[model samples]
Target: MPEEKQQTPPGSETEMNVKPDHGEQSYVGHGRLQGKATLITGADSGIGRAVALAFAREGADVLISYLNEHEDARETERLVREAGRKAVLVAGDLADPAHCRSLVDQAVQAFGKLDVVVNNAAFQMSHESIEDIPDEEWNRTFAVNISAMFHICKAAVKHMKPGGSIINTSSVNSDKPSPQLLAYATTKGAIANFSAGLAQSLAEKGIRVNSVAPGPIWTPLIPATLPPEKVATFGQETPMKRPGQPAELAPVYVLLASDEASYISGARYAVTGGTPIL
Candidate 1:
């Protein structure tokens, strides 16, 4: 039998047909993020959706800015509301600077204040070598992955008060390079340095900036971006021998966004399933 075709680009959780085990049924919160207003890009699915639901469960109203996955975005909103918190879905391309600015504006307008900004949206196309990567693809990757973060941070900081948190979704690739993801890895590395620089600049304002570098987790992006054979062995190459679940990374977002992490800034948290990043 032939293998089923996978969905591509900004993949949808709803169209996934088989529900991803988001651990929604098992995830519990103790109000670590209560009463906060958070803006999370790419919250329509994957790690973003997990973080959105986790934030909501902890009593934070979330604004999810995604590409164009309406079904996944709606499901995220529904689950957030079920957790007894408000969720707003804003769909647009983050590669545009104007749209990046609007994402911050809309979040603040809806929630009255933006306490946390999670720059989580990103795209990657595998290429065997630098020569194989099209110029357009390289530019698009950087625009969405790095440039949008700059735009959102600049806009979000205007509305954010002291104690604000900025969490960028970096990847383990930032430190460990996979030849196939050269351009994508470059962006992640840039994110790490960007987060560090921003942290220093924002320290005087009491705003903490940091990043979470995930190794591999089961999300729609896996099937959409990787070959089927590669997808089957997704996290097996990792020391853990299995891909992580989204829920596994949600708590890190909670800790970083809350006052509990007030003194933590300019740090990169490695949630890479035992992959050492020294």
Candidate 2:
């Protein structure tokens, strides 16, 4: 990690110093998600991009929901198409409830049905004190991180049939809070709880719901939110002594989305580089 790396909010992968590996060259699929219709928020970069790539190769048509990173989103769309799958790009703010619902509708419209939903988009900022956090920033974090997931699921479940899967992106912060990321960490905790409760409620409908809690991964979000000094030493605290790549987290998401995990739900899968979630 470089000491002088930083970026504006909602960062771009094209602008990264050392690009994160999205399993572009290494991932080989066997049609695990064959003919599935999927929608993924934040698919423009980071874990979202990696998941989109994996799903595409696994035979799923993807609807990519991103913020404003057109270049990054286009790159992801290219990867999906390259894998011989359909990819639709939809750019908007996930903080809006209306936009969240619209994303599911668009995916259903594009593929004629929706089978999987990955609520992975999130916003975070570093603050030394609670007083330094803005009321709007706090509200915005919850809106994009957890509220959007709820709204999207509400709309998607109607279109999804049995065997559908909903995967939410929780964080290591959900279990191990980071003081500087107070607002972001708070919402992550809420996401874990929300996923748990939602999973139980959706069980009767045969819709599996689960959450993935990722530790420090080498993504644009690192430089975008943390200071340069902190970014340089990012992931040092992990037992692996390095940050996990986006590609490393992809297989977990792929498994959850596939029918192989039909009996698994209401669980939190942690990709924390040996850091325990509990």
Candidate 3:
């Protein structure tokens, strides 16, 4: 990767210098999630988009929730539709608790019931020190990253049946903290703990809950949050010496969403290019 200028937080995927591979060409589905009704936050791009596409190809109808990235969201919708599945788009800020609940409501309304929920939307910013992180930024990070997941799940559980699944997008930082991403890292750690506790609580209900902790990945978030210098060498620290692509993480999500992972819950799967979480 080369040095690149930063975009605003929650960057636009279409504007990326090197477009991410969201399994547009490589992924092959096997009816793993056939006929399932799913809701995925941040489905506009990155891992979320990849999951949406994969789910569609696997025979699931998807409701895509985004944060005002219309162009990116539409592209994701097109991919879902292209895979011959239903796609619903909802744009709103996850920081607002009302919006979070509405996401679940809309998904249930659109699909009649929710079989899977992917809490993938997140807000992040890098700073040199704690003092540089503003109060509002810290609060917003937690609101979008972790709080939204809680609200969405609370509303979705009633709509979901015994075979439902919930997958949260955590980060390697949950185990190996990154000083530059203090707020974001903290929220990720909270998400891991939250998923663990929630999984045990929901076990009797038969709703599986898990987290995916990704290492450096080639996404718009890379250029948007990290400094140009750091962006240039992103993911090199991993043994793979390169970042994992959005497409690379979709299969794990597919398994979790599918009935195949019936016995898998309360676990955090790491896709870190050989970088171990512990």
Candidate 4:
């Protein structure tokens, strides 16, 4: 099969040539997350949206934070509400430190307590050369990708109780840095380290911190960030020879956010569809 590609800025799944599947009907929860309150950044689409649906179906209310993707965010909220769980949508730029902290406050205000936090929102752009990468872009990437995590976690941890969980979204680029995504890759590496280090720091409080490293998943970010040519063969370099659907990543997130992983902290679980992260 030949690779087909399409592009949309601030990526929209509806506009994507290959619409990303986010476990809409395939996921069935067994009450693993019953009665939990969660705050998920990037919950408007892709992995974040999938996680929100999975969590809600498993008996959790989710606070979804996204950046000006209202239509998509509303859909996510509808799905969560349909599952009989509360869903609150907070739209703003995560690159702003004040917005990051305010979101944590919004979630606590909505749900009264924060049981889970998924720092999954991120930004990236493909550059042919480092010289082409503007300094402002690099700083923006770091601010949104890693710096926002620090602010959100710092604020949310205060409202987190014993047994709370924090999940960060790293990427396959963290281990296998892509020359084209130099800035984004560097931030991913930082995420992996931050998740592990924060895990140990929070261990005494009965809280857990972990990271999920996904390979080329069929999400809007691919088309939105990568060029059309690169997007065509986006995940073909991996042994899987294809991209993973967003739905496939939900189970791992559910496990990490649940009490089932009580002993699983400071670890980076890779769903690379056969790419070795080590």
* Ranking of models by lDDT: 2, 3, 4, 1
Give the winner by lDDT: 1 or 2: 2
What are the lDDT figures for the candidates, one per model? 0.89, 0.94, 0.94, 0.91
Tens digit of per-residue lDDT, candidate 1, span 1-278: 12425778656666554455665898898999999999999999889999999999999999999998888899899989999998999999999999999998898889999999999999987877799899999999999999999999999998989999999999899999788888889999999999999999999999999999999887788678777777766788888887788888899999999999989999999999899874
Number of colliding residue pairs in model 4: 0
After TM-score superposition, the amount by which residue 37's alpha carbon in candidate 1 deviates from its true location, in angstroms, is 0.5
**Deviation (Å) of 88 in candidate 4:** 0.1
lDDT of 4 by residue, 1-278 (tens): 24545555558666666678888979998999999999999999999999999999999999999998888899899989999999999999999999999998898889888999999999999999999999999999999999999999999888998889999999998899999999999999999999999999999999999999999998888888888788777789989898898899999999999999999999999999899988
Candidate 3 lDDT, 146-222, residue by residue in tens? 88999999999999899999999999999999999999999999999999999999999999999999998888888
Report the alpha-carbon TM-score of model 3 versus the true structure: 0.99
Which pairs clash (backbone N, Cα, C closer than 3 Å) in model 4?
none
**Candidate 2, 172: how far from true, in Å?**
0.7
Clashes of 3: 0
Which residue pairs clash in candidate 1? none
lDDT of 4: 0.91
| Model 1 vs. true fold: TM | 0.96
Deviation from native of the Cα of residue 2 in model 4, angstroms: 8.1
